[model samples]
Target chain A: MSKVPADLRYTKSHEWVRSLADGTVEIGITDHAQHALGDLVFVEVPEAGRSVKADEPCAVVESVKAASDVYAPLAGEITAGNPQLAAEPEVVNGDPYGAGWLMRLRPAPGALAAAALLSAAQYQQLLDSEGD
Target chain B: MARQTPLFRLHQELGARMVDFGGWAMPVQYSSQIGEHHAVRRAAGVFDVSHMGVLDLRGARVREFLRQLLANDVARLKTPGKALYSCMLNERGGVLDDLITYYLGDSWYRLVVNAGTRDKDLAWIRERARAFAVEVSERSDLAMLAVQGPEARAKAARLLPPAEGSTALTLEKFVGRELGRWFVARTGYTGEDGFEIMMPAADAVPAWRSLNSLGVASCGLGARDTLRLEAGMNLYGNDMDESTHPFESGLGWTVVLVPPERDFVGRAALEPLAREGSPRKLVGLLLEERGVLRAHQRVLARDAAGKDAGEGEITSGSYSPTLERSIALARVPAATAGRVQVEVRGKLLEASVVKPPFVRDGQSQI
Candidate 1:
């Protein structure tokens, strides 16, 4: 089973979002998403200061098998993309919740609340319904 | 429901991630595909190839039957146990399937064909053999395993019966020796020295387990594909199908047009094409960019003016684990040369055209 941290919010597409004290949110793929991709070889993140809408494709994660798109969870303007991922894509496979964070975004007004993102328990239930 | 091989349960026990490949529930990877690919290049790895169809031919005219059936001259097999790789073609000179035929004796021969083409190949061979009174028997009761790498031979030889093991060690490349129920051949798709062993289905699990216990990593189809691609070998459906002929698919070397009068299934159509030269040629592409190349991607060969000279398409492509770069095999216009560009996700990335065999014997050849 994949880990769903109790403090984070998730989208059905498997992007996890964590709110910071500065009113910005950090985003990365969930453990389940990374595990399914298997050994990421390249990551192409959006540029800093770019605007993105909810559920829009903001980045690409490539494994040996195929390339997958990472969707943005909420309407937001990108603050930064992880520079570490350019040289070391495996971080997404190794530490998906921490160093593997894709980008940071400052949300548009009321975007987080309007997004209807799932809570940790709700996300776990969603994963459960997709039985092995 | 997808079919399962004899080693399916063992693969599940090893935590393999299974996928449906040509209606067979087979492992795509056990742990890591890249790791398995490296093992086959540096040390050793074992692959369950039981899904491939094996056929045994027996008749008074077995040799003559093959000479007329295959594009390559099986008459070249003067020594018993010698194997010849050739393409089985249609009357239009299009490839039906590529197979390995092992000459066992005057009246006996063995053939291993691709998994997806099994039924079609069997039916075609049976129809063709009727005139020659040859019996084409599918060895569904047999299973195959390929042990590959620089050290694969020495490690796998220890598991065979003593006398057979000694013979296996001394066997030359592309030769097969039968010991009891086992038929071991010194051949592999990976560009490494190794053996492909075929035995009874019941013996597959024990042999796989023994090889695994000896540190031969268990590889799946994912690694198998990358290894073959790096070796510049062709995958049937990806590289060539009924629409493509051998001369245009980088398999010209396997086609024998010698002795002029020797007629085979596709010789009538291929003869004129060979003399006039094929309109297209298969070439290798080395991408220096960060993106992975994949099948069906469009390739553009350009002239000095940066204008389109000719177009082509990538048949088989991937991120080569050994080269740490993306590479592909494409069928381009016959006169294409120098640099080419492959369009990936709408962006044209520059790539160099070169001869294949990208990696061989665990070393990068280009």
Candidate 2:
């Protein structure tokens, strides 16, 4: 079973969101997403200065089997993108929650609170409902 | 639920990640696909390829029947146990499947075909065999295991009976012979020295366990695909199918139109095309930049003025673990040459065209 941290928020598309001290949010794929994708060989994260809408494709993660898109969970302006992933993509497979975070974003006014992100329990339930 | 092979339970016991392959439950990987690929290149690896179809043909007219059925001349297989690779084509010159035929005796020949196309191939072969009175027998009771690498044969031979083990050591390449209850062939799909052992289905589990005990890495279908791509071998469904012929699929050499008198199923249709050049040609592409290549991606060929010259498609592409870079087999226009670009994720990446067999004998070839 994949781990779902109670402190984080998730989306139906499998991106996890963590609010930060500087009013910014960190984003990455869930453990379940990485496991389903097997070994990741390449990753293309969105650039910093780009404005992305909620539920829009903003990044790409490719495994040996196939490539998948990473959707933005909330309407936000990208502040920083993961730099280490370009040189070592497998870090996403090894530590998806920590060093493998894909990007950082500054949400628009009230966007984080208004977004329909799932709580940890709700995300776990979503994963359980869609069994492999 | 998909159909399960005899080794299905063993695969599950090994904690393999199972997926549906051509309506059959098969393992895509046990742990790391890259690790399994390296094991086959450096040491040894074993694959349970029991899903592949095994057919036994018998009758006094078997050779004559095959001559008209296969693209390669079966008369070349003069020695018993010798093998010949050929493509079975439709009357329209389109490839139905590629298979290996082993001459076991005067009236007996064994063929191993792709698992996905077995049903269609059998229907076609049986319908044609009626004229020559050839009997087609499907050997579903047998299981096949491919043990491959530089050390694969030695480790596998240790498990056979004492006398058979000695005989296996001397078995020549591309030959298969019955030893005790097993038919061992010195052949494999991976570009490595190995043996494909076929035995009674009941013995499959024990043999697999014994090989695991001998430290042969159990590989899944994912690794098998990368290994064969690096070896420059073609996959039946991906490389060519009912809509494409052998000439444009890098298999023109496998077809023999030399003895013009000898006729085959696709000969009449292929003769005219042979006189004229094919429009497309399959070649290897080496990515000059960072990224992964995948099947069905458009290949953009350019002229000296950097204008659109022609467009091709990647038939099979993946990250090659041996070369630590991306490689692919593409069917570009015959006139396409020099530098090309592969479109990936809405961006065109630079690449170079080269001959295939990208890596051979555990070494880089290009």
lDDT per residue as tens, model 1, B1-366: 988999999999999999988779999999889999999999999999999999999999999899999999999998999999999999999999999999999999999999999999999999989999999999999999999999899888988988888889999999999877899999999999999999999999999999988899999999999999999999999999889999999999999999888789999999888999998989899997778888999999865555677899999988899998889999998877888999998889999888999999989999
The local distance difference test score of model 1 is 0.93
Worst 10 residues of 2 chain A by lDDT: A35-44
Clashing residue pairs in all predictions, respectively, total: 0, 0
Compose the digit string of candidate 2's lDDT tens values, residues A81-123: 9999998999999998899999999998999988999999999
| Candidate achieving the largest DockQ | 1
The TM-score obtained by model 1 is: 0.98
Which residue pairs overlap in candidate 2's backbone? none
Give the Cα RMSD of candidate 1: 1.3
Show model 1 residue runs off by greater than 4 Å: B303-307
RMSD of each: 1.3, 1.5
Error of 1 at B138 (Å): 0.3
Each model's lDDT comes to 0.93, 0.93
